[model samples]
Target: MISWDKDFKIYNFKSKYGPWALVAGASEGLGAAYAEALAKRGLDLILIARRQEKLDELSKKLINEYSIAIKCLALDLSDIAHVIEVLSQIDLPIGLLIYNAAYAPIGDFDTIPSDDLAKVVDVNIKAPLLLAKFVSKKMIENKRGGIVLMSSLAGSQGSPKLVTYAASKAFNAILAEGLWSELKEHGVDVIASIAGAIVTPGYQQAQNAKKAPGTLTPDQVAEKTLKALGKKPTIIPGFTNKLARFFMGRLIPRKWAISIMKQNTESLS
Candidate 1:
């Protein structure tokens, strides 16, 4: 177990890396929480999301309150070419990258449209892969940086209703673990933030329900995630989530885990 220092200053992210951090999916939910947390830590930001209005409002709020440079990029993650073009034009060196955008299509795998599944792959897998590849190069040169990929508990099991989404998150988790091993030598930190049910707008919309008993707030997850950077290859946000992942991934049989997941997600059917 990694011992976390209670007084560790998260603002040290600027000292270890650089001045700027780029956050994908920064319009709302955990993305917006990350933006707020990072801003509080004194880092300039480049926020990207599909909604221009939301991004603009967030950027203004951060800029006014924190007195830090904020750039809002409203673009679809599925548009690889446009994303690449916009990122390529940025003059600042981005030392921290948070790939938080994801596509979760609920319901049976066969019932969901093929195009929707493909979009999930593109956003959750391809976008992160490309962004990491692009950012790691600059990080390797500087010999200091951090990357956080948003993963899910579903990723570790065969979630029936969220099959494609689970698979994509698994890919992200593995990628982060491998990169953490490989990049540590170069003074770069890679983390897979394995999150459970969080009280976010997206989650509420997707589940069509209010926050459950054990669900975490976005701020809570964001704070914990930032604190865990450079400390572990993977960090499960809440203690309850951590325990659940441990039991589901280790103690329980794989078939049993899948059965439990299927039952839990039956509402999505």
Candidate 2:
């Protein structure tokens, strides 16, 4: 079991998030960024994703670069039961859980198929919810650990084209808030990273226009998120994101906020 200093300062990374860390959706993009960041901190990794080849490729690179032990699980997060079963079989001391996988189906909500909608719920909401439930038990037992759930600023309001996705992300933000309150006394740190537009390959493929305001690199978001983990319940990764959240979530009225979000998302979806 790791000890918390009570003063809430993160004196060491491995003490809290190692000797092992697990990154879901870790094949690329933000997930891969988190994996690299944690590996630099001397944490052996258990990386999860649906593509075995990609996982193995990333695993090889990280092992060569960082010389840290790595375990790759090519399991789909949508299969929550199987994901949990595989994780449970791992004997490593995985004290850090980074849930970054999301299924985003963009378009008019009515135009999207029902199966895709269900997938959105399964991947974005169900997986993390269950993973948190499964992992937090061990964290509380050990009396120290961390959970970083990836949310989005788009979740701050009713984003028209991103309706279901936004709702699911909102769920993550609220879930982390509640978990932070409940787990802090147990020495478990929980944080929600409410990120903005990221300059990721996937985002680039989906983006039809110029870069959005407050667009951030995957590394920037990952680094800022890790830095904020033990200190706050939630963090908006960019200055623009923080300001946007302040205005949309607090200053502006709900209808106006929703309209702004609609305008922003309509073009992309």
Candidate 3:
């Protein structure tokens, strides 16, 4: 069990980081949960996603419930230039940035279209790189801030069907770790959240199943992530996930790890 102080107050967040946060992929699932959690912590938000209606609805709900400021940008992360432009216009200093947008294309490497592969790289890797560059500059200038990059267990090893997706997440994880080392001296905290399976709409759609064993709820993942921010360079959300990663990365041979991962992912397919 991953335990934290149940009585830990949200004020600690506001005091350490600033009063505003930016959350990408905020329409649903873990992104939405992050937005809600930040609101409860008394931070205004800038929400980005592809769905306009969903963004509007979420903005209204959070504003009504939390009474905090919110700006919704219904933009696709795949559009790199437009995403940069939109972010450039945010007048508020973003104290925290959660790069949660990702695309996972599951299939044989050759069976997947080239365009689909490019799109995954664009959203999962390029967008985060650009956004982090933009936000960390401001955070560095301010002399204090936080960033959370949403990575996955898939990033740790070869995933047969989720090749490009896993590779992209590996990029995210390594990027965040590098930034953490560089930024910590400047008073900015960076964390790569190595998540396991979570019960989100996106997960359901990707797996074409109702639920996966050992999966966590989106809220559980978000809350835990928020609590752990700025405390570590990387975090694996669940105890089971932590154990699995340790054994797979250390205890077994590289060939055996890849083979086991292939078997597990093939079962999902």
Candidate 4:
């Protein structure tokens, strides 16, 4: 993993008129890094996460460093009614939307509870679908916007251990690709970003004793993801991950692919 550097931007995206961006799961990880990057580019922000304290802390830090306007929303996306209320309330002309919140239950499918699976589905799949519909309607009326749906490399294959999570992410990956084809002609850039394992609070909390040699950092993922925004509709954040995806896509049989994913995720956790 590369060290985080404050001065690593290839090109800045300073908005001329304080256009806005919305980042879900903005308290930490790739979401937090994306928030900072957009703030540096002078985009006003609407940050959403389940934790109020983390949101406030991040809001203060961003405002102090970037001097941009910020609004914080503390809501669980799994709570469908609350999510609907929150989206309906956001009045800003959002130029970009980053759907970055997700969760996964770690275990064999039979052992995992239905409630746990449902929660992962709700955030990983439902929230993005609803948020995208809301944002796209507004952007369509205004004639421009962009969206980046956060997916996972595991989504490309099935996993016996993380069954629901993998399926949900797979849904997200394809959903964004379909949206890109539909929205690009409408002056909207819709992208799906398949992120590799990154060093984040959540990852650290769940990390195995034997950590991998080439895990990426959240900032590194964010940097590449931002650069890939309008140019590529489907982006795999790391060179290693991209190459792995390509090689695996060609050589692995479907049943073996699923077994490998299950073994790796369970062993690595």
Candidate 2 lDDT at 39 equals 85
Tens-digit lDDT track of model 3 for 1-269: 63355325666788667678999999999999999999888899999999999999999999999999999998999997898787787677799999998998888999999999999989999999988898889899888999999999988998999999999999999999999999999899999999989988888777554454558888889988888888899989988888889989999997888888787778554
Better of 1 and 4 by lDDT: 1
Q: Against the hidden true structure, what lDDT does model 4 obtain?
A: 0.81
Q: Residue by residue across 1-269, what tens digits does model 4's lDDT show?
A: 76345343322343311388889889988899999978877788999999999999999999999888999999898885677676677677777889999898777788888899889978888889988998888777766778989888888888667778888989999999999989887877888999767888876776572455457988888878877876878998888888777765778787877776666787644
Give the poorly placed runs of model 3, Cα more than 4 Å off.
1-8, 208-210
Ten residues in sequence with the least summed lDDT for candidate 2: 2-11
Clashing residue pairs in candidate 2 (N, C-alpha, C atoms within 3 angstroms): none
- TM-score winner between 1 and 4, please give it: 1
- lDDT tens per residue, model 1, 186-248: 999999999999888888887545454468998998999888889999999887888889999
User: Which residue runs does candidate 2 get wrong by more than 4 Å?
Assistant: 1-11, 207-209
The backbone clash count of each candidate, in order, is 0, 0, 0, 0
Candidate 4 displacement at residue 237 in angstroms:
0.9
TM-score for each candidate, following the candidate numbering: 0.94, 0.94, 0.94, 0.91
Residue 54 displacement (Å), model 1: 0.4
Model 2, range 152-195, lDDT digits (tens) per residue? 99888888888999999999999999999999999999999999
Regions more than 4 Å wrong, model 4: 1-18, 207-209
